[model samples]
Target: MDIQPTSGSAGQTGGFAAGGAPSSGGGLINSDFETFLMMLTAQMKHQDPLNPVDSTQFATQLATFSSVEQQVRTNELLTALGAQMGALSVSQLSGWVGMIARAEMPVHFDGQPVTISTRAADLADRAELVVRDESGTEIQRLPIDPGRQELDWAGVSDSGAPLPAGIYELSVDSYAVDELIASDGVFVHARIVEARNENGRPILVMESGQEVAAGDIVGLRQAQ
Candidate 1:
């Protein structure tokens, strides 16, 4: 499988100081500082000789600028960190290509038997695998060994006729004698054909053309 690395923008924005001037990068910071000096010089020159500007007020203005510059630097650092993490995530997902991932999604039957993986509820003595169509109609029920973790469906009807290829839902019903114990069927395994990014998240594309989030994968193994 040919897996391409996903590219994404870091979405870094320029950090502005208190006066709405950009304070990021060496060049921009120098410009902001020069602007500050010019403003301070003008203020000092225009001050009345009799009632000069308050020294405390000048100190406060300088402190405000300093705070803004620090905030801008912090933002730049965080942006760089975020970009590095995103690159690392893409690199990790690339390794998932050609591996079989177990998840809890609808089965895609394509001429071959579909392999399902699940576990019976605790305290249950028997398990039955229930197959349902797209319209929620129960088509077949097969007795399954409660102790087993994997089951293979031949994609055939009860009369031995081949079923059409499509997506189907499955559920496992656990029973103790005639009493229903639990209903659960959230497990299936499929080979990962490709890896892609969607909405800034890594998505694993299965051989059946289904897309699942990389984080949703419960188990993975080498594809045979």
Candidate 2:
């Protein structure tokens, strides 16, 4: 328990923003094209035979409208494709529910043992697991084996009492004799409760009440 204080959790929130999907301008453009057609027809009908509409100008107008319409159609297609891609990606992530993912982040201890993954410094002789509360105050420190990659924290404090269920920041501190050598943030194993697409990217909602980006997760496995 000879651990020094460190800058703890900043109470950052992990989340999703269900932004509204953009509207397609297809209908509006279609309506405008219809209006243009009507106007062109009216002009042609009202013009005297001796002063007919210039054919070149009429052709140019039609070509310009066609080009704009084509571009709009392409844009609509691309938008639809992007939506499909996002949905497909989320559908694949949906299977992540009920699985355990490894990521370095604060974990909510709900009276259950939380598995922590960490790496000790290369030259360290001793290591300790440091625990902090939601407010970033160091509350507990416990000895751990140097270079140990994984361990299950029993949610107990330095006083040997079960900690209340809440979010806690966890890390591993390495020391060489009297001087502190290095500190590494620890990754905790948490079960995925939900998966979603936020801003066209996959997001995982963990049982620990934290949301993590799929790319941030280092590992995944069937929940034990």
What lDDT tens digits, residue by residue, belong to model 2 across residues 1-224? 12222222222111111121122366787777776676556555544555444555555666777777787788889988988998898899898899989888997888989878878898999998898999999998988888767778999876779999999998889999857999888998889999998888888999767999998999999987
Error of 1 at 8 (Å): 52
Off by over 4 Å in 2: 1-24, 34-67, 121-128, 143-148, 173-183
Clashes of 1: 0
Q: How close is candidate 2 to the true structure, as a TM-score?
A: 0.66
Best by TM-score: 1
Which segments of candidate 1 are over 4 A away from where they belong?
A: 1-37, 48-50, 132-143, 158-160, 175-182
The per-model lDDT (C-alpha) reads 0.77, 0.76
- Model 1 worst lDDT window (10 residues): 8-17
